[model samples]
Target chain A: MLQTKKWRQYATFYAFVSPWLIIFIFLGLFPLLYGLYLSFTNFTGFNMNQLKFVGFSNYKTVFLDSESMYALGRTLLVTAINVPISLAIGLFLAVLLNLKIKGLSWWRTAFYIPSVVPVVSTVLMWKFIFSGDGLLNTLFDKLQLQPINWLGYEYATTALIVMLLWGAGGSLLINLAGLKGIPADLYEAAEIDGASPVRKFFTVTLPLMTHILFFNLIMGIIGSLQIYIQPILLSGKTLLDSPIKPNYLYLVHAFQQIFAFQRFGYGLALMWVLFIAILLLTVLVFYSSRFWVYYETDQEV
Target chain B: MMVNAGINKPLLRVVVYGLLTVLTIIFVYPLFITMANSLNPLYSLSTLLPTAFEWENYKMAVTTIEFPEYLKNSLIICAISVPLTTLSSALAGFAFARLRAPGKKLLFVIITSTMMLPGIVTQIPTYILFHKMNFIDTFYPWLLWGIGGAPFFIFMYRQFFSTVPKELEEAARIDGCSTFRMYATIFMPLATPATWTTVIMLFQGTWGDFITPFMFLRDEHYPLATALATIGYHLPDNPNVILAQPSSAAAILFMIPTIAAFFFGQRYLVDGIAAGAVKG
Candidate 1:
């Protein structure tokens, strides 16, 4: 009797969540599996009849392709540099904002306003700033420094990174919340022990804020890895820019090959590789976090 | 001792004030430049301050972009989608948090797992599906996806509902309240902060969304972001075209609604985000 009741209870629970499950199965899972299958076949534009199951060949092409290899390397390099620098600046700003100062709320709002601006506008604003005779160059000239080509091949990536960091206030705001959650008593005790503010921060603040740091670190990595809009918009691509900067072109090329060229199989393969890379990186971070991540609850590892 | 303490306090206050002012400028100057340039009269772009205010640029960009039509489309889409997204997520969240049903944990896990998938991966297939249904050009797909509710919203509401006390619901149940009333009267009112957070987030997200409308909507139905993107990208050739003149003006107009919303609801947004960061 108890078993039957329990089963009915489960059924009732599943019924409530049925809507999401149904959508996920059809929209999310089906497409994923279909994409994976399409990656192995030579499926082109709107026709699956021509899809030949030439297994491993598409994977081989992507792996050995010089252009794709360069894109992969570039993506990794950009992510590595962008993540740390943005986090450092964001943490610094969070610390600044957390201090008890007058008009603090206004300051917080000012810093966060840019983040809520539509991406199209933000990109356009950056475009204006980076133009040959734009604000950046004008400023450099006034400072008596030689003006660098802000959007040239050598500096375009750097410019994008800088644009990205301007909106770092969103993450910084979250960091402030984490900072506030740290018990005030801990800081008071540290001060009583004659610890310097810097020492207290390193010991009390940083240690307690690890969970939030972990959250930000994961979110930042995931968000940056799928970077598409800013580069595409700023670089003047209408659809997918063809012959993407040899370094930045691979993901776009893969996307185009799937959608434009009808090489669904190849696109799927590329996607799978990306998925695995992200999953592995996340898992690695979580596994290594055993040493540093401080959970409030005594949950099992 | 008293003299030294007073001296140190003032010095610290001055340093804090100085640092904050510099930081504010760093954050606000780009926006100021964008706004100022939009109102500049000269067709030739200047890097420094504008000599005169040109109000015509704003009017011209609005007319050329067919701003009224774009604004209507944005409002209609957001109005329909935000409520549907919030209500459905709240329902699902309530069920997950309060129901005594089985498989809740598994269902929750399944919903969250989808967050790992990048949106672009799902774009092509969804397009194909919508095309088959003959809903490509229409707003049906956008509405349907929004109504389906997002995992992030669901997760947020679940955490929020969990924080609500069980005693209220128990007392209501003893008073012979129906299950629906129990949720509507007790649970929903208590979860106002979370609901508002979800609504604001969905509103902001839907308003700024470009990729979906760009992929699905026809040219006649372009949303604000898509319309602006079209102008920004296509205006290089004819600078004198009414739409092309003072391109920065159009960008400024695109951002106005969002900036306004952020300032007005900033306190709630901050509180919600803070709670979310801790619980999430």
Candidate 2:
């Protein structure tokens, strides 16, 4: 009976997780391996019959192709610029909101309203607002200054960043959660030790908030690096017409390659390169975390 | 909730509240203008307020696209997918948190590491896989993804379940409760916050996802995100200028579900939801 019970317990675990296993095996694991396999072959999506193993050539193209290199560099530039600005602004807002203010929830709701609005809808609205006769240019005209091309090639990237930062409430909410997660008793203890507010923040709050900041860093990096849709939407065009060269993000480039140009194998190769790069960077972040990220739990990583 | 413990209280209040109030206006003004424009006729450079409360633009917004069909499809897809994503993720997360199983540690590693994998590496092959299986243009692929257990939501549920005191789990087991019973009866009820968070996330993700529909589904079956795109929502400012009103109006309509989800979910997301889970 005990032996039967052990078998039953094992079966129970499988029973609960069998759905995930079945779906993931066929959909997630198989496709990932298949993509890797395709990356090694000369599969042009429809050339299932005339396939040949052409290893490393596609990967070689990723490094040598000037456009690909530019796209990668631009992605890095975007990640670098957007991540820090977003973190600074988000953390600042979260800090402000963390105080014992009246109607805290109401303020949070009002603040987050813009972010929760549908992106497709909002993108168009922003497009209009940035249009030549739209509000911004109009204000310029009213001030007796020459109207600026807000959506022109020169300013489109800045326009895209503005749109993104406007909706950075997700950052605010997470930081608030992090702030709350810091035990209040820690603050009281610091007060007892005669630490000034500034000193307490630097010593007590900053150390405890590092884990959350680390979470934000990793998420921000991953998110900003893979940003594809914003440029596509903001460029006022379909996937066929690329976002202006300035906003031609790497994923967007890979997308155009696979779908528009039908370089399936090459696209797979490009993606794998990105995958490895992300893996390396993420590992670097994790390694760096040993020095900065603080933790109370001994939970296994 | 206090910060700046040394500052005079009234002075601090005046400054903080004053700054936040100004900041709120700065943030919300653009949206307010857009809302005003949606209800009124064309917004010239100078006009900041609406003279009329005409919802004709909203009427046009619904009529302009395959709104009814697309809305139905979105509703059907989210209604089915959100619960599937939430429940299955919760179950897997609970197992990771509580159960002793073979290769559990390895599975946890797999779960975390897969998150670092760029989504495109899998999308190409998955698209082909779906095409070969003849699941393209159908909701089966979405249903399948939901069953696959979103790795992110699983991590969330795992974190929540892990933080619940071990004594509670032990007490449930001592009462002759099966592990599954402990999950369904004890933990699931206590996990409303995590569940709500996952629900909103899954709903918004599925709602905003145009790529899946754009790539796979025929135009007739396109959802809101895809529909809005092909309907020439792009601004050219002259011939298509009249289209702006309906578009802004549609944006407000489009925002409702996700915003509603946030309002409902935010209550559960309040401070230390799990702190109260452990009973005396």
Candidate 3:
């Protein structure tokens, strides 16, 4: 009788969740599996009918291709550079805002406003800021310094980094929440024990906030790796204008090869490789996080 | 923790106020410059402040970009997608929190695990899938993705739902309310804050999103972001295009809705994100 009741309850539960399951299976998992199969075949353009069973050749081409290799390198480099810098800045800002300062809410809101702005607007804003005769250049001219090429190959990455910092508001907002969650009693106890703010921060705040930090780090890395619109818009591509030919950025190269050149097999192969690389990195991070990511539950540890 | 300090703490006050002033300037100055430069008659690259406020740039921006059409499209997409996403996620969230089911834990794990997969991996395949389904140029694919509950949204709703008192739901059930009715009448009303948070998030996300519309929609169907991009980059020579004014104006206009939403929903956002993080 108990088993029958449990079964009925389970049926109701499953019925409620069936919509999401059906969508995930059909739209998410099916496409993923089919795409995996297609990656091993020679499928190009919009023609699924023309697929040939090529078996590992497409993967080989991706591995051997210089352009793909360059893209892979650039993507990793950007992630490596941007993630740590953003995290540090975000943490610093959060800590500053967390202090019992006047107009705290207003300050927090101000810092977060930039992140909520539309991407196209932000990109356009940055483009104007970085233009040869735009704001930055004008400032340089007033200072009697030579104007730098902000969008040229040597400086484009730097420009991207600057633009990215404006969006650090999201990370900062989350970190502020993490800061607020740390108990006041713990800090008071530490102070009574003659611990300096710096010592208490390292020993208590940093260790306890690791979980939130880890979440932010993983999300930031993943988001940065897939960056497209900013660079695409910055390069000034339009419907009427010829598609901005990608320069050295690996993402642009991969995007062009897939969309512009109609090499779906190669694109799929490239995407899969990226997927595996990210998956491995994430696994490695989680594995190492056992030492540092302090879960509230001892069972998790 | 209150400090018993003298009233004449002049040095400390000066330092604190100075630091705050500098940071505030850094944050607010860009908006001021953008708004100011947009009204300048010449639209020249030289001036930091407009010699005279033209007021014509706003008019040009509205007329030239067909701002009304773009705004209409954005409203329609947000209106359709936000409610659908909120409803679906809320239902699934309630199930996870309240229902006892076989494979519940397994399903939760599966859904959460999907969060680990980077969006880039799915982009090409999903694009191909949508293309094949004849959804490339239409708004259907964009709407579908938005309405489809992502792991983050599900996790949030579940966390929020778990906090509600079970007695309320039980009483409703005892009053001959079906599970659906109980959910609709009792649970949903109690979860108004969570619903509002979800709506604000979905609205901002759909409003600001540039990539999906850029990739999927053609020129005639281009939304505000795409239109802004075109004005900023493509129509540099066409002075008549409203978006062709100094980039600052375009940026300011684009920021207005998002900034407004953030301020309006500020309290809920901080609470929701913080609580959600702990539960997650």
Give the number of the best model, judged by DockQ.
2
Fnat per candidate: 0.47, 0.55, 0.48
Q: Can you write out model 3's per-residue Cα lDDT over A34-126, one digit (the tens) per residue?
A: 778878887886677777989899889888998778766776777788888888878877877765677888887777777887777777777
lDDT of 1 by residue, B1-280 (tens): 1101222477877887788889889888888887877777745555566656788888877776578898898898898889988887887777788777756777788777667777777776677777888988889876777657788888877887888788887899799886667778888888777777788778888888887888788877878877776544234466433332357888888888888877777777777777766867
Best by TM-score: 1
TM-score of 2: 0.92
Model 2 scores a C-alpha lDDT of 0.78
Model 1 per-residue lDDT at A102: 61
Candidate 1: give its CA RMSD in angstroms. Answer: 3.2
For model 1, what is the error of residue B278's alpha carbon versus the real structure, in angstroms, after optimal superposition? 0.4
* DockQ of predictions, in order shown: 0.46, 0.50, 0.49
Error of 2 at A232 (Å): 1.1
lDDT by residue for model 3 (B1-280), tens: 3111221367766765677678767766655666766776644674566566766766666765667888777777777778877887888888899999868999998888787765555666777788879988788875676556666677888898898888887888779887888888888887777777788888888888755677777766777876776544235576434233544565677778878888888888888777677556
- As a whole number from 0 to 100, the lDDT of residue B140 in candidate 3 is 87
> Which regions of candidate 1 fall more than 4 Å away from where they truly are?
A1-12, A242-250, A299-301, B1-8, B231-245
Q: Write down the TM-score of every candidate.
A: 0.93, 0.92, 0.91
The whole-model lDDT of each prediction reads 0.75, 0.78, 0.73
Candidate order by decreasing TM-score: 1, 2, 3
In model 2, the Cα lDDT at residue B19 comes to: 80
